[model samples]
Target: MSITPQSPASPAPYGAWASPISAALVAAGATPLSSLALGPDGDLYWLAGRASEAGRQTLQRRHGARTDEVTPLPLNVRTRVHEYGGGAYAVHGDTVYFSHFADNRLYCRGGDAEAAPFTAPGRQRFADFVVDAARQRLIAVREQHPDDPASHAQPANALCAVGLPGSAAAGAETVLASGHDFYSSPRLSPDGRMLAWLTWDHPRMPWQGTELWLAAVLEGGTLGTPLCIAGGPQESICQPEWAPDGRLYFVSDRSGFWNLYRHRDAGGPADAICPMEAEFGSPHWTFGNAMYGFASAQEIVCTYIDKGVSRLARLDIAGGRLAAIATPYEEIRELRVGRGRGAGFLALLGGSPTIPLELARIDLSSGELEVLAHSIADTPDLGYLSVPQSISYPSASGRTAHAFFYPPANQDMQAPEDSKPPVIVISHGGPTSMTVNTLKLATQFWTSRGFGVLDVNYGGSTGFGRAYRDALQGQWAIVDVEDCIAGAQYLVQHGMADGERLIIRGGSAGGLTTLCALTFHDVFKLGASYYGVSDLKGLDQDSHKFESHYNEYLIAPAPHADALYQARSPINHTDRLARPMIFFQGLDDKVVPPQQSESMVQALKRRGVPVAYVALEGEGHGFRKAENIIRTLEAELYFYQRMFGLPTAGAHAAVEIHNL
Candidate 1:
């Protein structure tokens, strides 16, 4: 046999230049971090790679210490990659239940576990779940596609339940209650006799307004008539939890800031357990849990944000006093409190002057903090990574905004003796989401390659409070675009980046900002949008049940929507775009639809501007396949290099640049 010499993987030109270096680099599909639930036997249950080849939604069980004691829950298989709806997993007794997104069915693992589809998939999209083991039923929020004309105005959603260990055709699903446009936080009473959940309707996101409902479970496992326990049109309630003592506890924003409220009986008014001007529930935008667990019926432990700082707080329900359990950390991503156990774990990020996001575990009672993990990088001997400096920039309306700036640094690339490197301004999606000092390999990817990065927490972003988040009301495209422009200008004025080489990139709502910025302003010379919204009106009409009416606040009400939608949509104004841009979209995306990107690409082509468009099939809203991610990053790097007249050292696709 002839031995063939293996070719080496191509190395990055600016090797070892990345800052806040780590050993654990982000794999193509690797998430920065995730939360896990501990099983009754102390086995850890977490979602690993199982749903798709690009990403796995496996229910992993880790036994014993650091040895090879980890075993995935039986019946791990690739389901759907995007919009499968099921991600969060819950444990009841020895059985493990999780949502199967691909089939829109629920599955269980334990005792002769054969992964069979439980609930029928199509009529509704299933989300976060609560298992009533004794009752052999599962309570979940069902987001159903609308059916009638009025349904189009307000999408249909309801708190529903289904029998576990049953067949999909068995018709096991029971509608607990209806009239909810969106529903979440389903909690079953410890005795399995009562159910408590949260719901909010159209023209309002969950954070803006929500109601808490409690219902008795009938003998046949159907829900009795729901009683509105707490909240109204102006109030927002979240994370409804049933204490072991039969008391219903939830977080409410009744006092302008989110605080904890408890309802002892079916007809009683909710009593404020923890009251403060700090937020207990984060802005209801992302699909992750915020407040993890309740310690006791009276003592509550949760995460709260005050003035952009995330802290762990312990609430004394009887005294109405809140104590800061853990000192402020850089960011608290997830918190989990164990039942009857004073000791709980927290997934924390401590941003340092030299590190990006350092993951640590916090013990509530002892107040002991331990570093559990840190990101690792492949390169070595790189100069210490510079920490992001949090700064504020003035918006177009003269209001100060927040952002984090990471100066350019790389071990190999020394700026031509005197020239400052280029800068990349990033806008986070959700228009409601905020960028934190969390560890993100994508940011390092640019910075490590000799580029400065500005992660902007523009107006309408959360973590600062509601008023700040509501600032983007009726000003989505304008406020977001102005903030990005102002942030880049601030960097240029302060000599942080080369003004002539400024670039901007964003995804989803952030992508809208990117398109609007490039079209409305001449500051950025290059831009990239990932599965972004190009037509605001298109979104209002075609979006999913969860966000069907989101544009009502972001833009304007539906009756007067045509003019405002056209004005805010970048697709309509593509004729004014002069900067070189790249676009990425998922064919299966139901939120923004592929037409959003296609329209923009066609408009730019007609306008004779330089633009490149790439669409990934079998994906939705976001790219998940490893090959697609790698290709996107590589293509983007090449696009930037060619646009900026930088030296290309390797073979890359000859992309067709329109109107260049």
Candidate 2:
């Protein structure tokens, strides 16, 4: 629910307007919710972040009308596989298996008993589990890290089966499939006679290319000779699952768009199921990413992204006909069908422009939605929220880029007559990922303070067709930076923002874009980087095994990468950066280490350019602690107010702006 929209009552300077949407509220209210799953007994389960517990992740379950925490305090249900872990836990019947983040070991819990470690404490981490009831094991993707922390060798990833109690290999992991640089989605057949999984080698991210393999589960529990069913070095395949009738189904990008396809183990050509110019699959950044799931033998419940927005539909597997399921959500993160009496229900994590990310159960028969968990408990007034407008603007070479434009929205206040609001251009990370118009309190934090924002989808972002996604191939900084610049220019040209006060900010990969725009262009007068990349060589050298070779596709192969790295790195061109900027970095971030931010701060300081740096201890990659989030937001707002010469309305701890 929201307050009715109302006209402004008084005038206020942009970036200085006071609002009830404070930084503290944004941190406390924006609780992270993800990893939606359905239990065998019609129960709903999902992972929720406990910000107060130093950003610990806890598993929560809802049976009937009662909701309770499954993993209590001090027990963080998370995995470190690939550094950006997902699919950390899975449930079957009354049993649950999950990876304990602290020790990187697998734990099991059954019925009402306390969780206990099943796997020996070692350097191995497990994720993406599928229970093999017939075999008494759980098939999962295992990453074996080197015992010596100083070792330069990368962790070995493979498809391994962990034996449950009373099995021959009980309390041990037996390798089922190996020899691949990375592996995920270890799905077993309904009858447990066959297995299917995805694998990709170095220099190719899962989105760039992946191979789907199928093999017979031999009598001795070892996999027989495996055969490649689909995908290649040029084609990307995702989420391979066995249908109820034993036919294998998966998503492939051979059509320039990720679409559904089915293959029979009986040896026949794969058939495209409902081919369309939409994305039925996403980049396999983490494990267990399911865009579609089996609802019945003939019916499939799925979600696809078309032009940066998500749509829910029921696909007839036999006829290849898709029937749209009407829902308020503009973005659906994950979807899964229930079992037994709850088979008619679909569990998902979805959100819209008005709704925060939440765990929901939707009934196919009645189209009724039941809210299971909310990312945010309290909602802000409608007048304080800024609704985004999906927009596309012209960029270099007659090409177009997409973005979501948010205007300054405050019912109690408006800019003085005829004054345009200052705009913050945002570049999302993943360079491979796309941004949706979900109700994010972080974005609203700026809008409620009279600051307009432009969230750029940029070139190479997903949700668009493969062509648009491939636009940044080998043009990472150039293409992504251009789109952000063009978006800000478009906003200014349309009178939606003040050109003189343009700002750009992004984290991780987007941080590189922000730095590039501030270094190479004169459009943005101010900028912010949250754990941004300042040097490509530094990123490639320090990045984990998952993204170590990502630059080869984003920039070039190793033979040519050195030259491009030297030429395009923002740290190499800081002399051209004369604008005021602020940086936030996590000291423990192995993805984008603190050195990236420190070097840039020193460079700007020596040149007498206004700069501020905030290094957070006990944090990594992205900020998770509530205190750090609140501090960074307040510091950034203060930095912008001071740099833009706006009057500070509320009490904000002053940030030391070097050379200000």
Candidate 3:
């Protein structure tokens, strides 16, 4: 539901207008959605972050008309296993097993008992969990950190099983599989005879390549030689699952796009179930991402990405016929296919340009939609919303970059008659993850205030074919920076934005891109980086084991990487930074820690470039606290207004610029 559209009485300066969309409103409405699990008897389970609770993730379930919390306070149901952890919890009947963020220990709840630890409180962390019902244990990807904090930078990863006792296993865990740099998607066959999981080595992220291995579930919770069923160094596989008939099914990108494949017999080559140009899987940034599953033996429910938009469909395994399921969602994050009322259907964590995060169930044959949970409780007036346009433009080095463009939209006001809106070029954090079309209040907050936004899927982003994604290899800063510049230039030339007031912003990997752009080029007048990377050398040393050697692929291998570090790092070349910029950093961020942003700010402050810095306490790589989010948003708005010489009437933040 949206508010009725109305026009204002007169025009005002682009950055000085009175907006109905406030920073607090944006922070309060920006509730993100993640991981979903379904139970038998048509029960719905999912994770929701409360804004008032400082964005603490709570696991909630719906059984019949009753919806209640499964995870109580003081017990944050989250995993630190890859930092951006997903698949943090799973349910088996009325019992639930989850990872406690505070201790990095496994806990078990439900069955009329309070949640208690089942795994020891140590550096060992677990995620991507599945219940091994026959053995009464949990199979998960465990990251074993060294007892010494100094060596904690490197941890050994493996597929291990934890007993389901209500207390710590007394430092006991069965090592089911090991020697892989990373592992995910541990699934068991319906008969519980076979176990399947995906693993990939370092230097090759999960999206670059992975192997699907299957072995017999022997006695003592493990055993049997595992055979490589599908995928290799050249192919990337994701979400290995078992069909009702016990056939191994997974997603593979052998055809340049992630698509569905199935292995019918043991030691036999996997066959493509449905071949298409669209992608059936996304980059493995987080654990427990499922794009498709078995609706029945002959039918499969799935979601595919084409031109940066997601589509849901049903595929007939026998005839190879695919039927599109109509829905308003352009992005489907997590999905589950199970029996509801004894009928097969699909449930998806979905959203659109005008809708917030929603849990929807669609009947397989009827395509009927029933939305179960809305992340944002309040229904915003739709008149002020800016619908995203799927756009692509010619990029540097004769390549193409995709983006979602949202024009300035406001129901109560408009810009001057001849004034073009200021464009904000947003670079998504994942140099590997693609930008999807989902409604975000943070993005809407700017657009509804007469600002255009271009969220770029640069060369290194996923969702496009492998070739386009690989183009970023050995050209991390080069290709990404070029695509961002080209996007702003295109919009300016098309009269969609004012070239003088163009702004660029990004966080994490995107933060590095933003710093690089401001250092080497002068396309935009202002820039902002949220816990951004300013030094390439520091990033490699500060990153986790999952991405310890990622620089080898993004820039260059070591020995040669030393030279690229100096050449690409913005911190080393602050002498070239002339544009005004503001930086937001989390003091506790392990990835791209405080020193990275602090060094850049110190250099820019002394070099006569107008710069402001805001550091928050108890914050991580991304802002989870409501007050910090509100502070950063308000501070950024104030910085932009101050830089543009606009009168700040209701601005709440007062930042000090050393060289303004």
Candidate 4:
């Protein structure tokens, strides 16, 4: 579907802005894309998964053309059955090396057409791996579970190697490095003489701080003493790749925004090839990859967000000239540059409004783009989808906050002539994240059903730049909650929503904002939190490896964690939570344990406050299964309908609403 250029005179509402809305919707629940790797036969491979029933997730191989052909590997092959699976995968000839669930066992897929486990069920946990076809070994980041109490909080992740396409007991895996809290993105140098990877420790997210390490590959296929080549306390390294030349390249957030940086050797500092004020690196919550790719060793093509719009830009590494590559789309995600066979291949989303995500191959020589794959089958007709408009509001501290406002679009279901539609204020997760202008089916689900959505970027979101991202550093619960409240107030003051019927909803971190907003403020009369962090202390203790220390920055350090944790935890302030609330949680959630929600639910029940809690038995941090997604969506909708005395959409599932 093609979008007609929207004129400035006919500016769309914040939610109706085509580009930002579509991008935001697309990014809302996008999984971290595994790094794009080209197979020996030139076939591209990446990890793909979807939300599953009870939030028990599944990750499978997604090849070109056969996107629907998902091969579910054994969930218990490596990690626990309940844990999320599939990180980075490497395909060498007929064999595949990838991470499995729980035990983090490295699995090999080969032989019969059916996928059978090659590695023993209980073994090593692998992060990212590279197939050294010439050496006939798999170079991977192996993580060892810690034993001691203080160290139990930190796992031992190191670079290791093992014989591949062979017996699991053939050779003992050799650890190349140790003492690191986390390890990832192990890339073998082109000449096979060196290796590069990223590592960082406690209290720092990859975006906050990380270091890139490089080492020489020894004659026996082991790594020499690893050296800190680039990255430090102030910079966060992401997606480190070795160029065709011997030089190593990566993305760093040294200059406020994540930009491309290259290093010639392990001695000197990394040079920034492309620098900008927008984020080039997303949070490494999942394993795929991010950033611009090397078109040649000297030229790189990447997607960069500038002023909230994603654009494709070409950078001359040698000359330092950054130029925009014009496309018909306003936003682009998952960029991969493939050379050698043709001009190069890049995966991007083009156009606006009803246009879906399409993979495009760019001809480096001719500067032309060819459509490779389209995500949506049937494109909506013109005027069917509402375009989002960018709106800025003065936040509490006077900083201008960003949000996309979607007007009530379904013509058949207009609001009462005298009153505006009720507004649903959406707070995106990451409090460090931003809302984009991408078309999404989920948002459409609400708008099509007659709700106006105001997706707030709030104070700490990324797209606005570094200062904005750091705004929530110590003010986590406070700033994010206020921004969401301000967003709802903005809608009411603008005559775009009925102030009395305002509702707020968010999941995960967004869910935390939803809960905090409801408890600390009186703006929202009704709210819903999906697997949100109710107790900050519980989150610090129960979260997995990546985010265990995240609260140090969001709230406070460990010993002092109790005071801040108690004060910020919504469960402790049930007396102030007079508004009706609905919560959805995964019983298997390690990020924010089930007890977090259970405590809140029980407290609200005892206090005689209206509340509903639905727990998915086998789920984790987030709901994945299609049935669960549909069920949660419908349940929340039904809860709202009942609370507001609106027309019922049939008899929904009986949720135990407390104090009803």
Candidate 5:
């Protein structure tokens, strides 16, 4: 099924070009891979998203040359600790502990046996686990939801220890530390005598500020009074790990960058291990993020982001000299050190422009690579793939914004001569997150269909140090939206895209950027919002506890917040929105509820503006099921074709556009 290049005799219009990359293929090709963990027996464990099976996440194990499923069907290996869960499962020897998404109950499975619930089924969820074999217990972050489902109170998060079966207090959870708004990354010392964890308060996201706590492990699996060794309201800390030699090492932005630091003693100040402008850490949007691990007592292997790209390196702990470790990946999402026979091996989830995200184990001694799992079983040929060009463009107020520009790249199709392809500007979610140049079929689906794609890493994005990340401190919508517009305009000005057909689209926070760009300005001709925020006020009300007070940092606080929310809300100013737009919403989404998209769609319909809405049932903030992913991609493509008056492929269902 090789696709040969087409001759330049006659070309189709940009939007109407035929592509081999169908919507169905995109859904099937993009698999989610995350949370790499190395077992004591040298077995590799990770999570794989099952799109065909209702988007259930299954725990996967790689032992020797064989790969198998660890968690049985109907027992999804996930957690809802922060709603955006990670570190859902932890492995110790042959035993695995995981949180079931359905009941929020912690389940324990040993070897090939059926998984059994260990924690009492209630409104409690757990994540970021550490095994305390010496005490026959598991230390983790436990989020206790109020018993009253109708209550408006936020869930209480704390560091708790769950007794393993056969222990004196089997199935019982002992709260070790409380009074924190959120808790994560409970690490045990090599001797199991000490524990270190991270906590942060409300109104400040983990990336904005957090505290690292260290405490002595008292007898009977209890913790002594904890001491805050580093971090505060002005400093953000992440990934606090205990070195094999018993020293505490963590990432801190105290130097205006997330540099590595080591605390030799509780009473002494932490020493900077390697202070550089590069980011050795990322925003703590989810749980269990490890940027570096001890390869030995004196050497450390780490992944760092420099100028929005990731690089693998080895650091000499004593000399603080960093030496680059060559790898094919341009982005490393997760990293962990191997154990036992796998010692000196680094297990990571990594990818590059031509490679889909994959689980790989790299041998430090021999520089050998072994891929354990591929996000895409079979990726598209390189001829049809679009290699991204890392770009920096001038944005509002003479500030430079970064993005990855992907030009139309289909081997079998080409647009007419002198006709620039229509571009789709993508404002990535996480206004706090940074987008990498990893090979994503979703972006390729657009480029392969004669569309240029610009993935913007807006002002608030992580990487490039703390000051750059703080650019969106109180100017979320304004700064993010301006960056997206600037990226699109840069492409048009440089003759890379059609000036008259600029399109913008985003999801979650990025959705807010898309809506603002289309509503407040006339830069984008059309837009698409996938579970985007249309009304800032409504978003704050419907947001979960993890992000309830997030707006206090993204915008203003208290009384002044209401006015800013009203002024920035796209739904409030839809009267200025005359562009054609399509909206997608998941009925079960808790982050940005369906009302956000529905309200905007209704506004557009009433104003006689061409608009379409596609709602998916049983979906959450993001579409996970294969069918829904296919449907959304196809419907969006069809919508753009019909709006541009281009010939539709008609290979998928047509979207019903009102006021067309």
Candidate 6:
């Protein structure tokens, strides 16, 4: 590699600065975290995403001083129960049970035994598992799609019991409960007599409304007369768990914040243990998401997201007191307590600004934390990292919006004096999802190279509460776009960013927001959409079962959806879109199909607007392959350079912008 002398460090524009962070570095640095579990003893398990492995999720185990991969090659431990699936595996004693993504079948393996299929495969998919030792079966949520070739394929979902190998119930599926539109968290009581779960109907997302049900587990591994314990069409209930003493507990947002509530054994009313203005749970976008676990019968170790930051606490179940547990983390995604009568350790997966997503094992007696695995093996050099600053700004309709601002932070060189930084406003996908202050290399890649990034949580993001998340209800493009614009204006008004050089980018739901902001407004000069939604009606037709009717709440209801579909869809308003844009799409994406990006690109081409389209073959909703990530970042940077008329020296990473 040729080295350039720093003696000639001169003045440069905000987006045109040269830095050490490169597209290849950012692509190889990111590793997604998921599905944390606690094994016997001090062992911990988690799923680490390998972009180099073609975006496969691998099961990693940390036992004592040794950490190893539990799921080998030719086998990916993942599920497609709801398309956006999670909770793909469960472990009992030393044996591990997992659902394979390839064949959609349940497989079993352990120390001495070889990996083999345990459950018969068909059109059935399983996830969100609970290993019932007493019943010698695996309890899981199964989705059964019709086998007809030319069918609409509206599948049926149910809670099922798959027998373990070498057991009486082995390879047999006995349906315990059925007829719920969606099901999650099939928890068994400590005594193994009762079962509890969360269920929600269509048109109403889980956050909008859901019900917590409990039923008696009969002799033949079947449920009897499920009773609706809490929640309704108005309340949202999540994370149904049973403590050691047979006390049923759950998280509900009926009081505006998701807090802890427990069911009384005497058939009386369930009481709130510790009521606070904090969110004890998050949106169930994927299955098997957990935030709290019982440390013991008398205590519970939990993580709560308060104002976009996460905190860990121990709740005294009987004393009605909550005590904070200090840690180096600000975001906790999953937590699980040690099994059996001896509650020795607490296993959790969490992250912070300086820390990558890691699996930590906490000692219950001494309050000691040990990191078992790292999401990314090594952290970036401290000199090239961009620390995030949380800022709350005013938006339309007298509302407030949240964002994480990372100004250009290159330690090697500085921009010219009094030169305002060019800001790239980022919208998080999920539109329902909140952008946390995590140390993501992708964010640092821009910031370390002298581009300021504004990651907006907006109004309808989680980590605030139910009310804040529902802010996008019926507003969709309006609320999200306004919040983003408000954040950019706030920066410009504060003299922190260049008003004329503003940019916006996002993927999935955030992509829709980015598209709308450029099409309807002129606040941003350039934009990028990663598999973004361009047509509202097309989304309603192409969405999966979990989010099929999601547009009803996001935009409008059936009869009126047609009008909003025309007025709100960016594909229909392309005539107003004159700004330069770049489109990145995954051809295998089923949630938001490539047609959304393809149609928008065609419209831009017809109008003779400057545009570039990059499509990846095997990628999905979000990019995970290393090469694809590198291509996307390089192409985006190249597009922006061409749009802003910035100069690039040496062998340039080139992208051809049509009609430029």
TM-score, per-candidate, Cα-based: 0.87, 0.98, 0.97, 0.88, 0.98, 0.97
lDDT of 1: 0.70
- The TM-score that candidate 4 achieves is 0.88
lDDT of 6: 0.87
lDDT of 5: 0.90
Worst 10 residues of 6 by lDDT: 1-10
Q: What lDDT score belongs to each candidate, Candidate 1 first?
A: 0.70, 0.90, 0.85, 0.70, 0.90, 0.87
TM-score of 2: 0.98
Tens-digit lDDT track for model 1 on 1-660?
111223322233332232333212334324333445656643445544522355544554545343121324443332321133433557766667666555555666664555556666565556677877666677776666545545554435677777777534243777787776677778788898888887777778877788888788888777788888788877877777777678877887777777777786745567877667777887655443656466777677777776666777777778977777655465775666655345554444454333434445566668787654443323223342445888987878778888999876555455455577788999999888888875466666677677789999898888777777788988899888888899999999998888989999999999999989998889999999999988888887788656777888888887887898888788888778889899989998977899889998988888788899888888777776666666677677777877887764246644556777
Q: What would the TM-score be for candidate 3 when compared with the true structure?
A: 0.97
User: Which clashing pairs does model 2 show?
Assistant: none
Clashes of each: 17, 0, 4, 45, 0, 0
Q: Where is model 4 more than 4 Å wrong at Cα?
A: 1-35, 50-86, 110-114, 146-154, 167-171, 348-353, 365-382
Show the colliding residue pairs in model 3: 2-381, 2-382, 3-381, 3-382
Q: What CA root-mean-square deviation does each model show from the true structure?
A: 5.2, 1.5, 1.8, 5.3, 1.5, 2.2
Per-residue error at 660 for model 2, in Å? Answer: 1.1
lDDT of 3 at 81: 85
